[model samples]
Target: MNENLTIIWEKCLTFMRDNLNAAEDNTDLKKLENSFDLLFDNVQPVSLNNNNLTLLVPSDFYKEYIEDNYLSLLSAALKKNIGKGVKLWYSVMENKPAGQEKPITMNMKGKSVATPKMQETLPPSFSANVINPFVVPGMKKIHIDSNLKADFSFDNYVEGECNKFASTVAKSIAKRPGATAFNPLFLYGGYGVGKTHLGHAVGLEVKHAYPEKVVLYLSSEKFIQQFVSAAKAHKQTEFANFYQMVDVLIIDDIQFLSGKKSTQDSFFHIFDYLHQNGKQIILTSDKAPVDILDIQDRIVSRFKWGLSAEIKSPDFDTRRKIIVDKLSRDGIVLTEDMLDYLASEVKTNVRELIGVINSVIAYSTIYKSDLSLELLKETISKIAANQKKVINIPYIQDVVCEYFGIEREQLLSKTRKREIALPRQLAMYFAKEFTNATFNKIGEEMGGKDHSTVMYACDTIKDVSKIDKEIKKYVKELTEKIKQ
Candidate 1:
């Protein structure tokens, strides 16, 4: 057994030597040896599985310490010599030994002194004390709540032309929690557009992968609230210490911090500390950092230092996918036409989109209503339409001109021409249908045409749109653009 122990120790040492770049000086080697000796004295080997070493310690304290202090070194050593894809498991043993020695002690001089027997058995090169920079001393381990959903991972995030860039950057930052590429990832988008969800998801991923890593997920408002609480309790230093030590910091709804100068100052210091220390910082807001009102220039510049991504409103296909995913999860089925109509009308936000689906499900459950397109439109109109703004006429006109390969003046001009008149009449028809405007008002906006002419154009376009596939496609595209 002693011979086997010696061989294992030699192998571990050899692995360490091959991986680490600790100074070859005698002083550094002695320190590393001492750390290993102290670690081994406290840790015991468990059963091996699949070529992985499972070392069991006596307490959570040792488990965390070993992970923080030496896990990287061990992993590096194993991967360098044993090849890639090596894994190590460090678990805490539940039962204590009958007569375990006292835990290793650090003297007033900052030297780690082992027990007498341990000192005798420990190698000469393993007697000195060495400081490990990676180990965070006196960190209070936080337990994660298991009730949080796991499906909010990067895998489930749907990428579209609108949000593909943002999604990719978010995944990269989550996978590698540090200032590798995007130091402080800034994501901004409209409400109910998944900005907060993505921020929290990144925090969950980092925390799950590296349990020892201290990740704090809080809204900017909550952060301010905590800061204020700490100030009132005269625990300002304690609060500062708590934030300064975190490994990954995620702040959601950062736009709330825009006008609060004092809060921004405190946050500036916290941001600087974590960023300077190579830690990861992620932020989400409704607008880009520059557009956020009253934010200090320094803070704004720091926010823009990393990558910026925006989550635009989802397209038709993406919205339909979201509805289908939600309905499937709830075990509710709907006809194809009904699904298409919901996706078409509830095109504003994800929250509203899902709310429409839920209302339909509720109506079916309570009223025994058959799920049909007309029924969906009625139920969805009651809830979803109230939440939606009747899209403005000028907005439609601008969107139509932008969509079609033409200028606003060209569309409004009275040429009776086929190319321009067709688009101009379609815009007038949509404006009258979508807005609470009379034909006179609509005609005036369309370059002051007569109300009769507006009525004739509207009538002509309605008939033409039904038969003209090209006109129908352009109108649909223009409607979608304005809704977004």
Candidate 2:
């Protein structure tokens, strides 16, 4: 009977998918395909009792999504596979904690079964209203828009060895907020590797679990601007009070606060106030606290007080999964060979991988071209070319090593001599300046050093260049050479 359930569900899914494919949808193809995938991945057939069929779903969100978008199509498929009089029902399982949302699914032997709400208007993944980060007009309560993006939920965040530790820490903070030791969680990583995503995800989850909590998220630049405005009007106390009053505060790109004396000082006091009050603070940065430039020692110490998680670049296996999953959601299909090629070539970060995929999809859909290996290769090369002549890690290393008159072997070696060490540091610094590779990746190319080592190298070069005229001039010369 259980096997029959799986078999029947498989047939129904196929029927529904085929029908959806044939339907004339003025809606975006990606949205249509995404909706189909949402259901295929999330819903499973439980048991048939005479004239009724029950499907297992993860939450009421799934139930509402299916009934709202695909209820009729599902009804037709059920009629085709089960019986004309059969009705569809849902058994919504318990709401799992945020970031731990792997729904238990049966092996129907088809595409893993499920539910997609409408593509564009899908509700926030959390159950509660996202805390507005502003005061609502004419309302007794203050509501501020939190600016947490809906798509950055844990459901969409791909976890792997590179990001598992950080992802886990973010999840823990989400569950307990400031109750955990990871208060003022500091997340640092290169561009688009999900430091910002995890920051917003944590804020969203905290809002979801504790609706009464005043959760707010803003960029460091935004914070700075607000502070400048406050300073202009002599409202610094109001600014500090506004932030300190929040239960959970998330700030992205904290590295931007570098060298801004007034802003950093204000934030220092606000951070201290929040931490002393047991309020949770989340921050994202491009560099680790120890290597972060121009911030006060006290503020840097506070950044290190909580847990700091480093999100490295995703590896080949993780990259491959990202290509498949992201392309699938966007309604683009690639062959195994194509997927393998992409996973290997676009190895820098997730954001770059996504950009490449989007370009391919756009070209394919517009020109009606096949997603050939040649097309994929050509697309990747063009994108690579567009990345500023691909001033990449190896090229930067070659430039720095040759300019310093050091052998490539020594530059990439464990030698700590100043001649070799400074040039190696230059290579690491230039790789960061010239390429999109993450600190972890830059470290990898520069002989298995960790991200902190990469950060330290960059920091050392920047600090030395400031006071040492010779070093400063040499850095300028190398910068021009790298661009050329």
Candidate 3:
């Protein structure tokens, strides 16, 4: 038995040497072998009805990292050398070492005693500075800040008709920073859209592509905090200088800058400096520049100088892609039906979608069970069923009329002239499609028109939409904007 165990251990070492380039050092191999020997010494194989071999590790981090990164390779090696159908399990020992030698006996009354503890202990894998040799030399440290989450990137941003154009432009800017025709790009949209994700993606791309470039990515709240700190310390100039020096500036949630006149004034100077120097500036807010409250005209004009795009709430296809991408990254396999259900039900935002997926994964991990569509539905039903209050047609008409620089009376008028009539027809069409009102009711709401006029307006939109792609696109967008 001793000879067989020694031979098995040697075969395992040989496999490791052949398969892993990072573990090529002779000293590292010796240390690993010693650690394995120490671990196996304290864990005697149970003489049960199966041929299962369990290896004990010192920490949960060791078990998880090894399981995720190297378990399959190790199992394949074991099966290749020791015949076949060999099973292995890795678990962290619970009881602390007290120099005890407990006898491990099977139900058959056969017994094996644990070996003595090692004189030199191996370091726990979870220790702070224990570097994985496989990781890139300079990429060892991953710094996470409250304003900068590790998971916010283009990979997780869902794409739909509502936001496809904006997402595409953002990705292009990220791929080639400071090179796009639209310098100092500003993205505006409704709340819960992916404006922040696009802004963060720009920073992430810059860091990954041009690692040497100094990138300062922060939220407006962080900027306010730092600026306040600088003021308290009489170092406002220092803060300004630091912000001015970055190669790229990404500010998220710029809407928060509203009502803070002093902060906005300081920000305007920074914006001007960055814009004049050709440094890429990416800003995201919940409203368009012209609509932002209490913002200086100079700042608003500067914001509009570059291209302005908006990301609307994701549609069904985009939501599904978001779910699939997020789950795939976490190493979770979800069925098509499960993904469809999630995509259809969780239609709010990317963050909520990810939350649901995380919850499902956590439940599965905790229970030591397989993931099923039924389990996912049961887990998500409580959170997903909270219905959002549907907006009425009159509300949409009011917002749309206000947005297009048209009056409410003009929308209900029956004039067929292109300029006034086009916006009017659009209002009527939206009223018919988006609201719970009937044709007669919509026509009455428009301007005391008959039901036939409402039907004609709807038909006119459908016919024009089929013939003119540009008009169709604009109407579709207007519909989405009002709905969002």
Best candidate, TM-score: 2
* Tens-digit lDDT track of model 3 for 169-216: 676676657655355778876556678777877788778888777677
lDDT of 1 at 292: 66
Model 1 alpha-carbon drift over 4 Å, by segment: 1-151, 368-370, 384-484
Worst 10 residues of 3 by lDDT: 103-112
How does each model score on TM-score? 0.52, 0.57, 0.50
RMSD each, Å: 20.6, 15.4, 24.3
Give candidate 3's error at residue 369 in angstroms. Answer: 3.9
lDDT of candidates 1 onward, in order = 0.68, 0.75, 0.65
| Candidate 1 positional error at 462, Å | 30
Sorting all predicted structures by TM-score, with the top scorer first, yields 2, 1, 3
Residue 417 shift from truth in candidate 3, angstroms = 14
Predicted model with the maximum lDDT: 2
- Model 1 lDDT per residue over 1-484, tens place: 2455346645765676544445556553444454566656776645344656556566444553454446677666556544576456554443233476533322111222322211112122322223211224344553323222467666556555557657656766766787344768898866677887777778778877888887777778878887777667655555565666678888889989867887787787778767766799989986667656668888888886566777867879888888888787778787888778888886556766767778888988898867777777788767754675548765677567756677656776778788888889888988887889899878766766779988997888778779999877877877677665
